[model samples]
Target chain A: MNDPIKDFVEQHREDFDHLEAPQFNLAGFKASLAQEPMVKKHRILNIKPASWMAAAAVLLVCTIGLWFFNSTQQTKKTEQHLALNKQNKHPKIAEKPLVKAVTQNAKQTQFAAHETTSHVKKHQSKEEVPFIPSPDQMLYTKLNDSASSSTRLAAVLAIKKSELISYDMLDRLAATIQHDGNSNVRLAALSVLEKYRQDAHVTNLLVNALNHQNDPMLQLSLVNLLGKMQNVKIDERLYALVNDPSTLEAVKDEVYQILLKENKF
Target chain B: MKLQLILLFALFTTGLSASAQKQYKLAKNNGKLNLNISGVTVEGYDGNEIIFSLPKNEDEEVDERAKGLKAFNSSGFKDNSGLGFDVTVRGDDINVNPVSVANQPKLSIKLPRNVRVSFANNSNMYQDTVTLKNLKTEIDVAVTGNDIVLTNNVGPMNIKTLHGSVDASFPADLKGPISIISVNGHVDIALPASVKANLEVISNYGKIYAADDLKIAINPASNPKTNATGQPVKTLTIGKGVQALTIKSLAANSENQDENAPVFGYEGGNYAESLNGKINGGGVDFILKSNHNNIYIREKK
Candidate 1:
C-alpha cells in the first residue's frame, strides 16, 4: 500500500483516468489481417510417421514374397539335381526307357511263344554265359585294378545285379574276401556270394576262408557260414578251438557257445 | 648348477651328432617295459624283462642320428603318467608322444609274457608295422599311416587306425571285447569257427561282406530301416542268436521324416552302410567300423 508506484499512480490518477476512448473498426482490422500474407496454405501433403510406417510395411511384404518365391525355386532345383544324380549313378537300372522297352518286349513275346520256344531256349543257354552288357563287363575288369575301394564296391554290386554271376566272378569275390584292402568291398563281395552258397566252389572258398582269414570279424562270419553247413568236420574244428588253451578266451567262449547250441558238447 | 646346465645345453646341441649304440636291461626279474619308438618298428619278442636295442648310426655324414633312450632307468623307463612310457611292477603303458628327432632309429623291445602292452605308433611319412605275438593281457593299439599285423595274441583288443589296414588274429581262448575301427582302409579279422558274439559292423561309402555260409536272420519285410544309401539292413543271428535286432531303414509311414529333406539349411545325407547281427546267439558286443573302405570277417580254421 505504501509503494512509490502507488503514490505516482494516485498523483496521475486523474490524467490517466480522463484519457478518451477511440472507436474501433472490427471489419477494417479483419480486412487488413486478410491482406497481410496469410500462412500460404500448405500445398504439399506432409509426410508423417504413420506414412513412413505404411511404406515400411509394403517393403517388408515385398521382401517376404521375394524370399518365399526364391526358396521354392531353389527346392525345385535341388530335387531335379538329385533325381539327375540318381540316374547318372545307376544308368543301367534307372534308365526308364530301358525298363519300358523290357516291359514292351515281354508283352510282344507272349503272342508267338510256341513258335520261338526252341529257338529261345537255344539263345537262353548262350545268354546265360555272358548276359551282362559290355559296360558291366568292363566294370568287373576294373575291380581287379588298384582302383579306389568305393569304385571297386560299386562295380561288384553292379555285376551282382546284372546276371547270374559266373563262377569266375565268384572266384574274384572269394579273392576279395581273402585279401581286398577295403573291408566294405570285401563285405559286398561276400553278400554277392551269399546267393551262391550251394556252389561247391563257394563252399570250398568258405572252408579256405575259415582256414586262413585272420580278421576276427571276418573269422566270425566264416564261422557262421561254416556252422550253417552243419558239417561234422566243421563242428570238430570248432570244438578243437574251444579246447585249445592257446586260443583267445573271447573266441573260445564263442566256440563254446556255438558247440553248446549245436549239442556238440 | 650353472656348470651342469651348460653341460646339459651342450649335450642337447650336439645330441644328433653322437652315434652311440646302447642297450638297457631293465628289470632282470619279471617286470614291465614301456617303450615308444617313432620312425621305427618295435617287434615284440617274449622275454622275462625289457631289452632295448639302440643301433649305432655308423654313417658319419648323417648327423641326424636318433639319440638313445632320453631317460633310462635300470628299474624301469621314466615317464609322465599320461603321455610317456610307464614301466612299473604292475605292467607297461606305452603312449605316443610327438618327439621330433633327427633320423629316428628303430627300437626292438622284448618283454616278459606277464606284461600288458598299450602301444601307439604315429609316424609321419613312414609306414611302420607292429607285430605282437603271445600277449597275455588286454591290448590297446593305434597306428596312423601304417598297417597292423597281429597274430596269436590273447586279450581284449581295441585297435584303431587312420589311412591304414588292420589285420588281427584272435586265439580261440581270447576273451573280452574286440573293437576295430579304420578310416580309409580295410579291417580283416579272423575268428575261430565256433566264436559267438554280438556284432555291429558299419562301413560308410563301402560294402559289408559277411561269409555266405553264415545264417543271418534277416527279414527284409519286417525290417523297415534302410541305410542312408537305401541298402536294406540285414539283421540275423549267427550263434544261439540274441534277442531280435531292430533294424532301422528308410521311413515306412507318413510320420517318418524324409532323410533327404534339408535340415538346418543343410542337405541331410546319410552315407553309411551298416550290418547289425549276432554270432553264436549273440553274447558280448563286438564292433567293427570302417569309413571309405571294406570290412571282412573270416573264419580261423
Candidate 2:
C-alpha cells in the first residue's frame, strides 16, 4: 500500500510542479485596505510645557490672592469692630468676632441702624460721605454689649445727659426698659423716657413695656405713668393686669386706684 | 551627735506644718477675688495672699481603703487644694469654685483688706448665710435665698439678694455708691449720723423706718409744676441749709397706719413707698430697696 501511494505522487509530481500560482496584485490589495474603516490617531494640544507650567502658576497665584483678599477683608472688619467697641469705652467686647456679635444682636442692631439712617437723613439735606457713628450710637452699642450692670447704668446716665435726644435714642431706651436684666437700669431708662411721655410712640412703648414687666416697682411706675396720661387706651391693659393672677397686689391696687380716678371702676 | 539629729527633726517638722496652709499670692495693689461658692466665711485681713482652709469634720471618719487612691468627681475636677475648692488665677482676678456639690466642706477664706471681692452663691440647695467682715474695698455680692451680713465695711458695694435679708453697717467715713436690693426680704442699713451721702430707701409691700437720731428732713412730693424741668428735683432744709428728703408713700390706702410716729411718718400699706433724702451733706449715693419687706435706716452706734 505504501508503494502504490508513492507511485501516484511520482506521477502527479510533474503536474504539480507545472501548475503556476496566481499573479499578485498590490493595487487591488491597497484598494481593499482603503475600503476598511480608518483608525483615529491621538493628537496632543499644540501647547508648550513651559506654557502649561505658567498656567498652573497663574491658577495657584489666583487661589492665593483670593484667600489673601478674603483674610484681609476679615481683618479690616475686625479692626473696624474693635475701633467701634473702643469708642464705646468697652474694650472687652473687642474679643468676640464681628459676625457673632452682630448676629447675636441682630434685631437691636437693625432697629438702631434704621433709626440712625432716618435721623441722619432728617438732619442733612445734601448727600454726605459715609456716615460716621455718633457718640450716642457708640453708646447704644455699649448698652447691649456691656455685661456689667453698672456699666450699662452708666451708659444710660450718659445718654440721659445728651443735649438732643433723638427718637431713636428714645426707642433704644424703651427697649432697655423692656429687656434690661437689671431692674435699676430699667428704672433709670424709665425715668429718662418719662421726659418724652407726651409722645405717642413713647406712650405706646410704655404700654408695651407694662406687659413684659413683672417687677412690682416697675409695674407700679408704669401704672402711675399711664394713669397720669389719662389715655383710655391703657385701660384694657390695666384691667388685664388686675385679672391676671400673677400680678402683684400692690400693682393691682395701683391699677384700681387709677381706674377709680377715671370713674371706669 | 544624737542631740543634733533630734534638733534637725524638730526643725523639719515645724517647716512642714507651716507649709500646710493653702495660700495663693495676689497682686499687692488692685487685686480682685471672685468666689462662686457658698457655706463660707470671708474675712478681710492685712495679708498679701488669699489663704483658705477647710474646717475639720469630727463626724467624718477616715476611709482607710481609699487612702492611696486619688478622689475624682463628676465635675471633672481633682482635689488639688484639699479644701474642696478649685482656685484659678488669671491676671489679677482670682476665681474660686467648688469642685463638687456633694460633700462641700466648710471653707474659711481670708482675703487682703484692700482687694475687691465678688461673691456669688449659685447653689439653690445650699442657701447658707454668708458673713463678710472688715472689708475696705468694693464688694459685689449676689445670692439666692442666702442672708448677707456685712460688718465694719467701708464700701462702694452693690449687693442683691433674692428671698434673703441684707444687714450692712458702715463706718463713719463710709465711701459709697452703695446699693443694696432685696426681694422678699428685709433690708437693714446702719450708717453713721455724721456721714455725708444722698440716700434713697424704697420698699414695695413693706414699710420704711428711720431712727430718731438721723436728722431726716422729709420733703413734700414734687408737683408737676415743681418738676418743670421733667427731672425729679428733691430739696430739703432740715435745721440749716441742707437738701431735703422726699418720702413717697404709694401705699397710703393700706389699713396698718402707725399712730405713734417716731421721727418719720409711718403709713402702713402693701404698696411700695420710696424715701429719698440726704444726710448731713449729700456726697455719694446710697440706695436701699426691698420688695415685700421693711427697710430700716439706723444710726450706727
Candidate 3:
C-alpha cells in the first residue's frame, strides 16, 4: 500500500534538493522575542493608575474619619468633666481658671526669658523650669477646699513659714479663724495671724473675732494676742465680754487680768 | 384546731417584732462615716457592715403607742434606718443624723475597722458623751458640751471640744498627729510605754501633769533671755543685718513652771503650765491644748 507514495517522494527528491532551504535568521527571532514583553508591560502600566487613586482616596477618608471621631470624643470628655465639677461644687475646681492664668503668666515669663537667650541656653532652661503651683493657689485651695482638718492645719503652718504674707492671704486666714469648724485649724490660723497683729486690719479682725468666738481657748488666745498689742483699743470689747453671760469664766478672768495689767479696770 | 392556729399566729407576730428591733445593718466597704448625732458609741469590728442599734436595757420596754408609727419631731429628719437616725450613704461616705433632736438616743454603732470616722455635735441641748473604741483609723471629733472618750485606738485624731473633756487611751503602737483641744475642760491621755511621740501639752490657765514613767525631753525656748522687767524676750534674726526684738510676758509662757511649781500636787509626777517634750525619742506629733483646764499625760499600765 505504501509503494505508490514512496515512488512519488523518490521522484520529487531531486527537485526538493535542487531548491535551496530557507535560511535561519537568529536576530529577527531574538527581536520578536524581546518585543513580546514590551506589549505586556504597556498593558500592566495602563491598568494600575485608577486602582492606586482609589486606594489613596480610601486612605484619606479613613484618616479624616478617625480625626473627627477623636475630636468629638475629646469634646464629650471635657463636657463631662465640667458637669461633674459643677455637681461637686468644689472651690478648687472653680478656681481652675485662676490656676491656669498663673501658669500662663509663668509660661509667658519663660518665653520672654527664652527670647533673650541662645538656643542652647533656651533648651537648658526649658529642661530646668518645672511648673510649680504658686504658694497663693496652694494655700487658697488647701485652706478653703481640703476636707481634712490636718491638711488645713498644715496649710496654715506653711503660710506661717512663708516670708511674704499677702493681704488677701491674711483675709483668708482671718476667715478661717472665724468660720473654720475645727478648733485646731482655727488655733493655727490664729497663730499665723499673730505675725500681723500690728496691722490695724489684723487688729480689727482679732478684736472682732473675740465676740463671735465661743471657744474659751480661742477667746483666751484672742485676748492675749490683743492685750500684747501696743495701742489696740479692745478695752471696751473686753468689758463687753466680761458683761456677756455667754463668755466663759476663764475668758472673763483673762480679760480682767489684762485690764488690771493695763490699769483700765 | 382554732386554738392551735391562734397560738401559731401569736408566735409569728412576736418573732417578727423581735427581729424588727434587733439591729439596722448597712453593708459598707471601708471609707468614712460621718456621725452628726450625739450620744453614740462607735466600736470597730471585723465585719464588713455598719451596725446601728440602741443600747439594750433589761428594764426598757418598747412603746406600744409608737408601733407602726415613725418617730417624728421638729428636726425634720426621718428615721430611715429604723434605729432612730437618718443614715444616708453618698459614694463611700456614710452620714448618720438623729431623726429627732429632742429624742437623741443612745446608739451603739459597730463599724468596720478600716472606716474613718468624724463626729460633730454642735447642739448645746445634746450633751450626751460620745465614745469611740477599738478603732485603727483617722478620727475627727468636734462637740460643744459632750465629753469624748477614746479607748484602744491608734489614731491620727483631731478632737476639739468647747466645754467637754477628752480622755484618750492609746494602744502600744500609737499612730499620731493626734491633737486634742478642750477649751474649758480637761484632757487626759494615756499612752503605752512603747509608744514614741512628740508631745506638746498647752494649758493656758491650767496645769499639765505627766506620769513619771514617760521619758520626756523638753525642748528649750528659742530665746530664753529676760528683760529688766522679767519679761521673756525673743530675738529673731532677720535677713542679713536685722534683729527683731519681741518682748513676751511671763504670762504668755505655756510653761510658767517657776511660778506654778509650788502649787503642783502630783506626788511622783511633774506638773507645769505647758510641756513640750518627746516621749521615747519622738515619732509622731501629739498636741494637747486646753485653755482653762488641766492636761494629764500618763503611761498606760
Candidate 4:
C-alpha cells in the first residue's frame, strides 16, 4: 500500500530540494550587525561626582585649619619675642629661659636669616636694639597708668601668669592691694603678694596696708599673712588689731586664733 | 581728781538724755547722704527734706518729750577735697564719716527717696535696722551691729557687715557691680525676674541655694581643680548680660598660699566650700562673700 506513495514522495523530494532552499542573506546580516555600535559593559567600581565634591570640601577644611593653626603659632611667637625684648631691656636679668624656648621653637635660624640681618641694617643708623615688647610689660604699664579696677584686675592676672616679674612689679602689686577699690582686685593682689612673702619690702608694704585698709577681707588676709611668718615682728600689729574695738569680730577671732597658735594668748 | 570725775559724770549724763528735734534741706545737686549712727533706726521715704527724732529708749516712742533730734546742712572740704555738702542730724553728719554715740539718746532719721546714700553702723549699735525704700541711685552700706534691709532700690551697691545679716531686694535690674561681703552673718539677695548679670558666689562655711527657675552654673570655672584651701568657687551668669554677680564664703584659710616662694600659677581659691554656679549664662562681675554664713539667692516672686 505504501509502495506507490513512497515512490511518488521520493521523486518530489529531489524536485523540492532542487528548488531554492530558503537562501540566507549572510552579507546583509553582517552589514546590519556592523550598523549597530557595540556598547561597553558598566563596571562596579566607578568614581562619582559627589565623591569629587566631598574630596574638594575636605581639602578646603584642612587647608583652613592649617592656616588657623599657623596664625595662632605665629601670634604666640610674637608674644614670646615681645617678652624677650622686655627681659633683654633689663640688663639685670642675664638669662630668660622662656625667651630661649620660644625663639628656638620659632626656628631662630630662619628668623635670623629673614629678620635680624635686615633689622641690624635698618637700625644701625641708630642705637635701637630693635627689640620686641612683651605682653607682660604692656600689662604692667597698664596696671601703673590705668585707674580702672577691671583693667587692674586683668593686668594683675596677666602679671601673675608672667614667667618673670621684677621687684618693681611686686611693688606695684602691693600698691594695688592697698589702693584698689575693688575687693576682687585686692584679693588677686594679695595672691601676687603671697609669692613675694619672704621679701622684707613686701612685708613692710603689707603692714602699711593693714594700717590703712578698712576692708575686713583685706584685714583678715593681712592677719593671716602676718601669722604665717615665723620669728617676725608682727605681734605688735596683731595685738593692736585684737585690742582695737573697731576691728571686725571675724578679724579679732582670726587674730585670736593666731595668738593662740603662737602661745601668746 | 574727785572733782574732775564728778564733772565727767555730769557731762556723760547730759550726753545720754539730750532731746531735741530739727529739719534741714539738701543742697542743690547734693543728693548723696551718708549715715553713721549708733542705736538709731534710719528710714528712707519720698520727701524734700530730712527729719530726725532722738528717742530716749530703743523702743518706739509715742511721747514727743522722750525724744531728741536735730537736722542741719553743712558744706566744707572733707579730707582736702572740694567743698562737699551734707545734712547733719543730732551731731552725726549723714554726709560725713560715721561717728560713735555711746549711751546717747536713740535716734530716728527719715530721708528723702532717690538720694545716693551710704549707711554705716558700729558694733555698739546693736540690732540697728537701715531700711531704704524706693531709691534710685547707688547704695553703699556697712553695718557691724545687726541687719540691713534694702527694699526697692536700684543701681550699684557695695555692702559689708561684720557680725550682722544682709537682706536686700532689688525691684529693678541693677546697672553696675553689686558686691556684698559678710563675716559671721547670713546673706539673702532677691533679684527681679528680669535680672541679668554674671554672678560669683562663695561661702566658706555655709550652704548656697538658688531658685529653681534661676539657671546657675556652680563652680563654672574652666578649671575644676581648686587652689590651695580646696574651697569651692562658683560663677553665675544671669541672662547672658555684661554684668556679673559674685558670691563667696570666705574661710580662715582659702586658696593655696606659698609662704616663701613666688606663685606662678592660676591662683584663685575659696575660703570655704562655696556654693558656686552660673546664672543666665553670666555677665558683669557681681561678687558676694561670706564667712560662717549661709547665702540665699533667689528670684523675687
lDDT of each: 0.55, 0.68, 0.73, 0.59
All candidates' TM-scores? 0.36, 0.56, 0.63, 0.48
Answer with 1 or 4, whichever has the higher lDDT.
4
Backbone clash pairs for candidate 3 read none
Clashing pairs in 2: B235-B244, B236-B243, B236-B244
Cα lDDT tens digits for candidate 2, A99-132:
4445435544665676777769877776544445
List model 2 lDDT by residue over B1-301, tens digit each: 9999999999999887666554544445456878887766788898877778754555767889977665666766665666667777778787877777766766777888877888888566877777888888877787867899999888767777767899988887776567788867899988888888776676655777877567664433332211222343233212211112222221222233242111232122224566666677576667688767888888899
The Cα error of candidate 4 at residue A180, in Å, is 5.9
Interface C-alpha RMSD per candidate, 1 decimal? 13.6, 12.3, 17.7, 10.6
TM-score of 2: 0.56
On residues B195-257, what C-alpha lDDT tens digit does candidate 1 reach at each position?
Answer: 666566766545566653344333222222232244443333221111122222212211334
Better of 2 and 3 by TM-score: 3
Which scores better on TM-score, 3 or 4? 3
Top-lDDT candidate index: 3
In order of DockQ, best first, we have 3, 2, 4, 1
Q: Each prediction's DockQ?
A: 0.01, 0.03, 0.09, 0.02
- Lowest lDDT block of 10, candidate 3 chain B: B238-247
| Runs off by more than 4 Å, candidate 4 | A1-170, A179-216, A224-249, A256-265, B1-23, B27-31, B39-115, B123-127, B219-271
Candidate scoring better on TM-score of 1 and 2: 2
DockQ of 4: 0.02
TM-score of chain A of each: 0.44, 0.50, 0.50, 0.49
- Weakest 10 consecutive residues of candidate 4 chain B by summed lDDT: B77-86
What's the candidate order when arranged by decreasing TM-score? 3, 2, 4, 1
Candidate 3 lDDT by residue in tens digits, A1-265: 6798889889899887887878889999999999999999999888778899999999999999999998687555433322111112234644664554455467657765655564467456454444455667778898985567877776786787554455567778888988887888888789767755545566778888976777666887888767766677787789989999987777888789889987889
